[model samples]
Target: MNPNDHRAALADIQVTAQDVKFSTIVCFLAWTFAVYDFVLFANLLPVIAQDLGWTAAQTTGINTWVTIGTALVAFFVGPLVVDRMGRKSGIVIAVTGAALASGLTFVAGWMVGALGVLGLVLLILIRSLAGLGYAEQSINATYLNEMFSHVDRKNGGGASRGFIYSLVQSGWPVGSVIAAASIAILQPLGGWELCFIVGVFPAFIMMALGKKLKESPQFRARQLVTQWRSQGHTAEAEQLAREYHIGEETGVSPLKAAFSGESLRPTLTLSAAMLMNWLGILAFAFQGTLVLTSGKQVNFNDALTILIISNATGFLGYLFHGWLGDRIGRRNTIALGWFLAAFAFAGMLWAPNGSYGLVVALYSVGLFFLIGPYSALLFFNAESFPVETRATAGSFINALGQVGAILGGVLFTIHLSGLTQESAAELISSTWINAALIWGTVPILLSAALMLLARDVRPGRQS
Candidate 1:
């Protein structure tokens, strides 16, 4: 087999079990708090809107705009930061940026008076900086994929990687819960400004912990080749490339390489799938409180309670999907989960009103399928690409997902604004309900179909 760019697949890095444990802990906490920052913005925006004189429509607009900036920032982080810098640097900067975003929210309202509407612009700009943190999911996948590749190489694939990475990916639900629970608890005590300020601490702490992270061995190896080539050590570079059995694309742009040749199909497919899945996320999860509160008898607090409970179920789903991916395959696991999620969500929508117990049950089930597969999704996405383009591919697809978020947000704003006050009040009766159905269900199913187009690279021991 030319060792054929496969020898460096796992890069015989000297990662100890302790290194894995330590990196996982750091990634988990960083992602957890990054999510805390991300989810908190949505949950507390109503209060922030109230304080800032924005209508619900305006709040949605702000979210959409921020997502645009977030997509830009996320793209920059993946290719410019993660690809250009080391993974360790990328992760550290991500958490630190999230901390900065959360801390700056307190001043966003004050800017309206000084910068006029541009004050709000400043707020969007500030929040979008957390896009780096949002991109942390990609960093975790690439970092851990490299780390996990070294283990059980004798086994056909890195059997335990998906399951272990699932533990880190659970940061999403944990952070989401923390965001909601903190708002429930803290909003009354001071204000959302307090919550925003409070949100900064955890991310900052995680950034400190991220400092302890060792660079991924694969990344170091790649850098060594690049360095050797740059220093005119062409023979050394070629020899190392030959030794590792990898193609030497030393100076090629990772993003460009990601789109060329065989990388092109998976890149396009994965990007589209994430875009569709994220549309679903925006419709159901991002605007979760709205979906539950609309046309239902539940108050905001009750809706919040349901969100807290339902999202907790995501933690279990991650573990289960992670475990399942190890046996069957990460790609298959993601597809099955998302496909089932469509029906479960349909059941959620179809159930009769006044059945709060039934609503909660269906909603939770839907989320279990919807959000759970992500535990496998990130790792699968990472492994699908060659090492050279791993971070770029992950980030590129992830950034594309924000396009779905933007589209979903715009659709939500249009639908919500079209609703008369009375019509908007009814959950099942409004065109808004159809909006939910389209964004929430159809996109999920499509994303699942797209995943089937994926041809994943199986794990093998480093040559």
Candidate 2:
């Protein structure tokens, strides 16, 4: 405990590259399946609707309800479970549940053409279950946070996590590619049933691989969750005590205790950050595909291709942004991202017809900024909240963000159709106009303002 001993201990402190790499890979894989399952539902909606006897309205309704379900359930219940059950159990159970739900989707698809209300009901239920699993984003964020150390937590917070999340986020594009390719390959052989049946394979792999996955070390350290310590593995518990400053006496409900009057600044800041984060998610999910859909004579393949490109580009930007956030500051990086996204959205509104090159460029730039903040905010939120409410705050913030997502879908539907424009060119213009209004100017400005008012919570900085 003397200065010499402390200095010596600091000199010997080391975290191997191998450890970081292995941890990152595991997290990436976990997130990849999580993203795949979440996005797969939307990616194959066209096939699902056709094979399941859904009208346009009905299909849209299904998506709306799923968002609503995610917003409602994930916001409150998801955090409670994650906080109470611990990140390891939350992820494992969520993955297993999603796998089972996907299996059911395959079964429902088998009854296609002659599908009944029963089949439709089952599919909807399964989709809702998958939405529940989507709540794993919070758990995954906690897992990644726990895997790294104090130094790693500060420098590698978003940098490492962004890369992992980028890979996981890539699941959307990959799932779309897989869905499109599978439908093309299997449509002739076994019809849409083949696509759904094939879909179950990935979930199966994810579930099995997840079996080997260990609980996050930090999760074991938290004072609120006791199961990790109850297993009698004191090495991890003791290590956590030394590293994270957590001990058995301190782990209580984070939400209940972390948000006292004294902690209002962090509470409000995280709430705003999470709110905007979910809004971005909504915009990406609905607007990304919609932009291409509004493209003249654009096919599903082309739409999916554009999405893949956007996601790929965004992934790279995430890494760049993570570095920026760690080096510069989370608030500055996030604000810069929002501003860039806003600018890109504005350009998209004014671009000429069939200007696919310019369109993609602007959209890509916007997405770059969007993901920089999105990727980094996980750590920002985690660091801002106390250990007791860490998971709870994430759950609440993310759950509330789902409301923004629901609005994004509804806004797109309303404005795009209600524009009173006949030509596809005009429709595209109007859609961008509406998107600019919703996602571009206003949201960015609001987020930037919020960031300005918020307190920074990066670790190592005393409040």
Candidate 3:
């Protein structure tokens, strides 16, 4: 074997158990906090709207703007920033910014009486600013993959990676549950503003945890090789390159590398899948609003109860899909998830009005299917590119997904306008249900079909 191959083999023996533990905890919490801040506004929008005298259209418009902000950051800014700054620094800044923005919501709420329309505008601006922090999620995914390289490739691939990623992605439901619980507790105490206030705490926790994080070794090694080469220490660079089995230095920009030739196909395919997934999530975002405003008009406590239950069930789905992805492979698992989610959403739409049990059951199952396979999907996206361009590619796909979120928000707002208090209950229920079918079920099925074209990147497997 060549010296490089031997060195690569030896380097693999250097990973320690502590490294895995720290990487997993730090990445998972950072992701969880990022998602928590991202979704916190959605959960509390109704109360905020009422306080600000904003209409449904205005509310959805604000959310759409947030989606747009997320896309812009994830696609245009994140790739460049993360690639240049390193993942650890990028995530810390993003998370800190998002947390501070979330805290600003309370200030916006307080200004409503004085600023009126300006307060609403400020709220929208802050929330959209918070959305920029979502770039951390895509960046961190790449970090985790590199950090867990050894374990991720063990047992035919995806054993450790799948479990860790699923756990990390479960941060979505966990964040949602925290949102629900916070609203449940805080809303009654000091009203909606308190919910935003409570949401800010997770950021501090994440920042503290983030301080303990080490830069990804892969990133460090790559930088070292680049530095050596630039300093004309070609021999040293070559020595390090063999130890890491690093590929030839590509002259192309990361963006060009991500979409060039063969890579373009799977890149587009995963982007399509993510777009549909976000569309469904945007529709699902209305569940709280629908339950509160439609068919029998349940109280805030009841609506939150339903949401908590549904999100709790979503946690199980994440675990299931993580396990299933290892067995069936990422593409198959994601396809199955989308298909099952479509049926579950359909059942939710078809359920009788005022049937809380049935609605909750269907909602829970639908959410499970919609959310469970995300970790595996993300893993697949990360694996689609080389280490050099992975973050950019994943973030680019995420940016496309945000476009779907914007569309879903717009569609949801338009549909919600038809469900005024003067409207008949059946009409109100059916209008939102039909919107859910269109926004949730249709795209999900399309995503499933698109999954057929995606290449599975599981270790030891070829598509």
Highest lDDT model number: 1
Give TM per candidate.
0.91, 0.77, 0.90
* Candidate 1: 10-residue stretch with minimal lDDT: 1-10
lDDT (C-alpha, whole model) for all candidates: 0.79, 0.59, 0.74
Better of 1 and 2 by lDDT: 1
In candidate 2, what are the lDDT values of residues 16-131, reduced to their tens digit?
Answer: 54555654565555555555556666766655665565643355556767777767766654456777766666766666655565677667666544557665666666667665
Give the distance in Å from residue 315's predicted Cα in candidate 3 to where it truly belongs.
0.8
Query: What does candidate 1's lDDT look like per residue over 103-191, in tens digits?
Result: 89767756765786778779889989878778989989888887676434433456577788889999999998988888888888877
Q: Is candidate 1 or candidate 3 better by TM-score?
A: 1
Tens-digit per-residue lDDT, 1-463, candidate 3: 3568547744744555587688677777777777777777777776776776666556677778767776776686456777767777877777777778778977877886788778666766777766556676677777777767644444244455676678887887887888788788888899887777765776777778777777766676778788668877688678867755455688888788778865788888998888887888777754455434553355656777888898899899888887788777888999999899999888877777678888788888988898888877777776677677777788888788788898888888887765554567667667767777887789989999899888766642311
What is candidate 1's TM-score against the reference? 0.91
Instruction: Give the clashing residue pairs of candidate 2, or none.
Output: 223-251, 224-251, 254-388, 254-389, 255-389
- Model 3 spans with C-alpha error above 4 angstroms: 1-15, 150-158, 242-245, 286-288, 295-297, 416-422, 459-463
Q: Which number leads on TM-score? A: 1
After best superposition, candidate 2 residue 304: deviation in angstroms?
2.0
Off by over 4 Å in 1: 1-13, 50-56, 110-116, 151-157, 232-236, 242-245, 295-297, 420-424, 427-429, 459-463
